[model samples]
Target: MIETDAAGKIMFARRALFAVLFLVTMVGSLCLAALALSPGGFGIFDVVVLGLFAITLPWMVAGFCNALIGFVIMRFSADPVAAVLPAVELVRDDDPVTASTAILLCVRNELPERTIRNLAPMLEGLCASGYAERFHLYLLSDTGDAELAIGEEAFFSELIATWGDRIAISYRRRTVNSGFKAGNIRDFCERWGNRHEFAITLDADSFMPADAIIRLVQIMQVDPKLGILQGLIVGLPSTSLFARIFQFGMRLGMRSYTIGSAWWQGDCGPYWGHNAILRLKPFTEHCQLPLLARDGEIERHILSHDQIEAALMRAAGYHVRVLPREDLGWEDNPPTLLEFMRRDLRWCQGNMQYWRLVTLPNLTLVSRYQLVLAILMFIGSPAWVGLLGLATAALALCDDPADVMRSDIGSVLLLWILVMWFSPKIAGALDVLLAREERRAFGGAGRFIVNFAIETGYSIILCPILWISHTIFLFGRLFHRDINWMVQIRDDHAVPFELALRDLWPQTLVGCLSLGLVMYSQPWALPYILLLAGGPACAAPFATVTAWALLGGLAARTGIGRLPEETAAPEHLLDLALPAIKSASRPPLTSSV
Candidate 1:
């Protein structure tokens, strides 16, 4: 018995060492790949391998690090820890003097009028709060097109004129959209950051209850070390079936991960660009625009600038926190499957950019690992595909089937992959029911099943689309292609089937290839292959089906089976969507299209 126990311990230690060694090798491979990017470059295959190695290493590291951090914090920390609200100390609202806050809403070309109108309720909620006197609203527009800019300006002006001092309103339009959102915010800081002690940054489509913003600011005042506080963003369901599923997944399953992440890291967790409050001085002074070496090509405006900026602040010894989604900040999600993919592809490019960061100097091991983990999450789909491909190829070429099975090794590897893939969702689901404020969003087991059906199905479809899109984005960077940073363009209406077919064809191709390969190489793997294939192949049908069901449900509820009406929106959301009100002679905000 003693000997068996000793053997088990030895095996565990060996696996740990293997994991570490594998990571070190990955780091080395990335360094070589990056080094190959000099004037004298390597061949296409070499560049591709190097690029993949470099981009993927961080994700691998981040997962390991997140687990390790969870262990340490859970074991060592003496604080009341929840990922969303870490160390929730009882804060007294002593500041009866409603501190004035400038809610900075950054927007591009979209339905400015509709988005602004939707956010009216939230803004009204803020005004209803005693601190209404202290909260000022700023509509920052980056809409560059003449017609859209004109439309936005008029819409914003009317909104402000209509509101008439319920909230002090200001607007700015950037002439050239530099640095995406980060640059837009930086520009604001340079022009007027000093005007306010703190700024609440929001996406054009995002909204938070007035109290959440007020409370966040009050908490910031209490903690001097904090630089940025990220609020949990709940997804708002829309008419589209795709939107409904994503909203549920994000609100329930995904929210927990953000909460767990925030709880584990507290201030170390990076700032999400939207639905967050930030200290102006640190962001402007410390979060300088990253100079792009290839200018419009590689490293253009730091693709994931928000994460990078948060990393920079943390490295500089400032705190960045993830606040609980329980506070009620909601965001407009991508309404269609295609729109979701387009947005994710951009994210893939930015996440891949983190590889350049891991090699930079002065980062803590924890932060470096965090960047790596994020990278992994982005690239995991392709990596899984590639890994599966390699295993099949190896088995096909080899004579001994038993040798190929290598059941112990394959089983462990497969298990780890599954855990990494599904843990976030499971973690999130757990967090949803646990958080008092968010629990109401999710019902009992019935809602859980519905949410799962939508998320699992939608995520599967998105996998292949993103895998290809990210591959192209990464390939562009490797070959040094010029890439522009743009805000995710949001549309309220569903896209036509023709557009859906156009976007889905590539995913269909890869998924088909994967299915063919799995059948030929390992017939026993049929069930898994079909399971994965169902996501991509049936994506359109699934969405259509889901949408039909939702419509039917809505019809059953309302006497006239018409489309459901949009709920009253928050005011901060309106401020974000309304066109950039042109101040005295500045540049016009650019349109997203």
Candidate 2:
């Protein structure tokens, strides 16, 4: 019997909050040490700090340097060289019409009505696009529930009845949910992929604008060298505080990741599973995923199949690419912080398993290094925080408070924290100001400033929570603990205050101890250290309490900050609808010989 009382809910929230705080403390400590502390201890800190200052100071001082260089180069350089390969226009008078299938992978226990509502646009996309006759849609249900299956069948039937012969839709149920998502797609490919030249994969919550789909097909048809083309995946910020923050930060911080990946990777950019298209033959041929060794920590159905598949493609000498930013698609954000953390934990476990792949034979240096770098970035947060905590304890216990105060290490650490806290936001703010469409979402320059402030403030609060959670997750993985793959809950918005309290109490305890230590010893380094220790210790509750305040403010001010102006469905898409027939073409799909 589950308890319905506030007490139970509060306990859950407190646990969640504490998880985040723990991660932050552990990460902060490690990052400070890694950046400042050298092998010889305090003696090295000065040299390392001065070196970094020299390296970074120039970039800060020479803001106009790159722009001026670019300006001069562009003036003298030949028109940016066009692609040497001529575009293979699929619509050419003599080309064969290529038939492809769309595989929409629906995971465990997904909501029925929402799935249908969200997918309706894609169905319409098939009919409206010129390739209606050449594409078939398959909804692969990994869920075994009898009721949801029945609901999906009915919904699919309704779609057929409305559009008739113009669109074709079908459903498939797997006997086993093995390999998680990777298995789902593999199973479909073995059974249905041979019938199509390409397959567009979609996660349950992923959606692409109609034109984006058309563009995907065009690129695949033009470039036979391309095995996969993945587009930018943006977040849909549902009306929740946590959702808003996630969407805002991702929109800003992820550009560097996206741009850097595409630039450095060229044709080998990693696929993110959804919002992407794949040429069927190459994927089914080269991406025959091998089973992991018995000693491997990752489960058969692990979290990062996408990364693995991309690596396999490169190993097989095929090309994968991140489509330019012009292609637009969106993914729904997990509605609350708890959901986000749960999803991330599953990913951490899987990625930690993949850390071994860095040493796999026959891999390109770039691919190997990228895999290793990802592992470091993911695990480094916790390691950093743990080191910071240990350092604080050492200063308090071993060094005299006066001696620690006189050391320059503490000030360098403080400066590093400040730079990390604000630099990304400043970079993103500049990007937003530069983009016209993003600027409209902020409702002009004044509102953009307000939006940036709210988002940046929330990020500072969330950083410690996520840092703490990651630390706990990394520790658990290192000890070989069992971690479950959980569904990222998308609709729950409000977290009960009692739950928040339960999750936050552990951080509160840590904070109390740190504050007490600083007050009693008055260590010079303690003041700088306590903030990192006390932040998640204090910020979690402050966030949970203040969650409703922003929405309340927005409620009074009519439309101060909102999503971009809704783009109306273009005229051409209106007439197209799902087919009006209850029949599956049941095409014979066999594996490539």
Candidate 3:
């Protein structure tokens, strides 16, 4: 076991290594950009391009650094999970569960039946663990719809009658969801937080098996210093083509990205607001967010509350860690492009609000950095769009080939940026490929490789479109547009061409104009411009087609973006009858289940 001093030394070394990798990439890339632009004698257009290029580097660099480290760990480590999360070794599976944990199921205007379906497995698992008494389940509702509230009440009453005796279970609903989810949780902490030693926060869409929940509780019980132990949450297998493809990439990207991050991030890791356990006492006392608005106002409240809470928790001297283990925690992602955009925009607004909270006192340097990184995560989108726009305009004005850049250096720089931009997924692919058993679990190396390529192209088409959405959103904030938290629509359905066109015209317009400028001024740059601007150009069609029911079913039939859960589900997940599991002809991946 690593001593406290030894752990601190290892943490320092890893962070320093990350810093070196990030700085090297930034410095080297800027120099390449300067060299490429220097050929024509750096002008205003060249200078602004370089500035935007620099602004875009951190996000990409962070991903590359994390992925590189993560890939190395996955490729080399005998036990990758332990390599990243050494604290896991402190607790034993058979460790006596002593602390009482509050299972916080935070929901707002959600379908109660669906929410209940996701909760039952965990309750049953807890009962089987013979530690059901140690866990209290709270169905905390923030439903605004009158009809939905009725359903929620009925569901809770039924759930309470059934499981109240088996496990300590209760339900509460706020008439007004004041601070949204943050408020919902704050209400819980104030009411029942002191009663329990820990709280496991779960969203309406989140699920954790019984053993996973028990393991987290045990880990926390063993380590009193751990304020937040965030489990890695993968997307649940889905029938929606958009969701499956989106999550397949997520499943691949988040693993290595998380492992790499946890290695250096140590105690200042992420809290994704769901599928994680938190110590309730310090959390209730110290993580209180400054309410943005008054008594009943909802619009002016905090939207992105998880990261700030994590920072505040760290500020209070408690460790916050993300466990980089897969198939333990799962969630249902946005089922279509439109829902995805709405969710992204909400977060963009929320992160922008952190400009005020980032100033909160007592935050550790790393905690402050995490807050800033959250802001940059959204800010980088506009930088990307701006860079692409300026380059397009630069091409439009250039008559001669030597007018803007030296082609060789420009090509190298573009390739470098593209490679780094896709580095997380690239590293994720390598992590799986390097492990023979991992490849088999992903339905063999060949299928996994093919899916990787398809998901990459899907991302290429989707990212820029979302970038435009994010760019527009940031601009709207300047004009005081009200972007508040809205209940997520989490069901499978086909997107109409009209709805896609209405929401995605900006992307299409940008794409069309970019192509026209390239063809008119410098015809040769069209191919290069297509790689950058083409996604938005094809946005409407991309959304409509991917959300088409027939296409989705066909994709599912062929297992185009088949996740491990779909290829062979856990026995526990089998009862959930996930789309893939329902369709599977094979056995589960886990022998014990």
Candidate 4:
């Protein structure tokens, strides 16, 4: 176990300060509002509402404070922290270094052609940088389908024929997908991990610059104790309106938030599964995940393994760091709202599983806190729905309806909710506007403002729909329902109208019932009621793939959510990679070579 050093002490002190401040702000604001709402006296309903508020209020405040700290750091700091490799100069054609690193591309039953296309650029970039000899590339496949396996082999053969002479490229397909991606990596470690000092884990859609990859290796070489180092991954290039808007907001907010979190977290940071480097020996020794059993029944193995791995490494006396770099890495986003939720469904289940592991023996306090925060991330949605239900119940039981509506407490609570919910977006917008260079990258002040306005409006409408859907997913897990391990829908395709309605009708129903109830007793809450009802009413159309595509296209044409990558493509990397993949010689479908 790692001892808390001077830096660690400072980090802990700052974290303690933030924690106390957050608790005080959250509890004071909520308690004051509770007292004001029930001026006459405390009733059973008031007590219940307050208790529910106490449970949910910290989640909201924690997010707000994180964003608030991020905004202050980005706005005030002379030189804000960013994720950049140390002193990476342009490599000479003859420059070569010797370091053994394995680049593992773990794939399930995904489109093999697309995966090759994505991999081609990084391969070409490495060759061009003269680092081709330093790294070995492995296409580790856990494909279960017989036909897909054949296709994958055909592509792999072609790739090997072209690049085998220059780079140590190989392919292996496992008949059984045993432990999923984590298991796939563990298998590799057992077989060949000892040969390499470090391994860079990548997802199917992950793309990193050659320089960035080399930089990661160099950093690991310097810090022998670093177990995992995660780079910031921005959304990949997208023309679709939904993706552009979603990515644009993410780009704006992710940097500042990450930097601020890193400052407080210090050594004990997050490890996103992909676009990160792991030290092989330490990972092999400390990161084997345990299977959890409950009440004589063995539950499915852990779905989200990255964070647990990081925690395990830290518990074994290693540091896990997240490098906040904008240009280093890229990954794809779900192109439509329905696809987004489908992905969220899996993630919600995985994050919720952490509840079982938080109390695991010998884990650090910060590590445990991280697990709790992750659990709260999904659980907060249901808790939010619970809070609204309690408030509605209190309203129903109130003897004087006029007092409930007219009290200054109602206004304060509404204002508090709105401010806390949207403050991160506000801070992100400020970060964009404050820096002239960043502002110009997003197409100047006017375009930036327009994009923020549109994104905020869209998010407000989508909030309740997501809330209801997440609540359903969480409750489903409570009943021990099985989640299918399905390939993500990466391409933009139209969702059928009937299918959209079938999936989202429950959300629509909840919206209608909640709005109807509020309107009957408290017509003054029409504004909030409308916000709750809007998402469900719009769910069918938004859920339709074609509808969002059209909206995304319109938004793109109007310059609402413009990102720099869209305007300025990474020509050096993509130009070399895309052409090579398209023109590469391919073997016949039936060829066994």
The number of the candidate with the highest TM-score is 3
Candidate 3 stretches with Cα past 4 Å from truth are 293-299, 586-593
**Candidate rank order under lDDT:** 3, 4, 1, 2
Q: Number of backbone collisions per candidate, in order?
A: 27, 37, 0, 2
Candidate 1's TM-score reads 0.76
How well does model 1 score by local distance difference test? 0.60
lDDT of 3: 0.86
lDDT score, candidate 2, position 239: 47
Give each prediction's root-mean-square deviation over alpha carbons. Answer: 11.3, 14.1, 2.7, 6.8
List model 2 lDDT by residue over 1-593, tens digit each: 35436633653454344334434543554455444454344554344444443333322222222222222222343421111112323334434346575645555657756666556676677666666777777778777667766776776677667765777677777756778778888988898888888888888787666667666777677777778878778765344556655666666555443543343345557788888888888899988666665456544545578877787777777778776452367777776666776787777777776766777767765567457655654665554465445555655575454333334665676665455545444555676676666565445555566667777667655665666777776777667775665545666356666776676665556656665676566556456655556556664565464455456233223322233321122232222221100011122122111
- Segments in model 2 whose C-alpha atoms lie over 4 Å from true places: 1-101, 145-147, 160-164, 294-299, 394-402, 405-413, 416-425, 435-438, 503-508, 519-531, 539-593
For 1-593, candidate 1 gives per-residue lDDT tens digits of: 99758744764554455357457645654554344333235555335544554554555444443444333443345542442353346456655534456789988776676657655776787677756667778888888877888988988888888664787788789877777778788888888888777889888888677777777887777776788888777765354455655665555434435534554455577677888888778877887856655545534567678877787777777788876544457777776566676677677777777887886666655577678777777666565455434444543455554543444544454455445455556555554444443333233334444556557756666555566556556656678664454446564454555656676665566566667766777677666565445456555554445445455234222211111111222444444442211110122122111
What lDDT does the true structure give each of the candidates?
0.60, 0.58, 0.86, 0.75
Query: Candidate 3 — worst ten consecutive residues by lDDT sum?
Result: 584-593
- Model 2 shows how many backbone clashes? 37
Q: How good is model 2 by TM-score? A: 0.76
TM-score: the better of candidates 1 and 3: 3
- TM-score against truth, every candidate: 0.76, 0.76, 0.96, 0.90
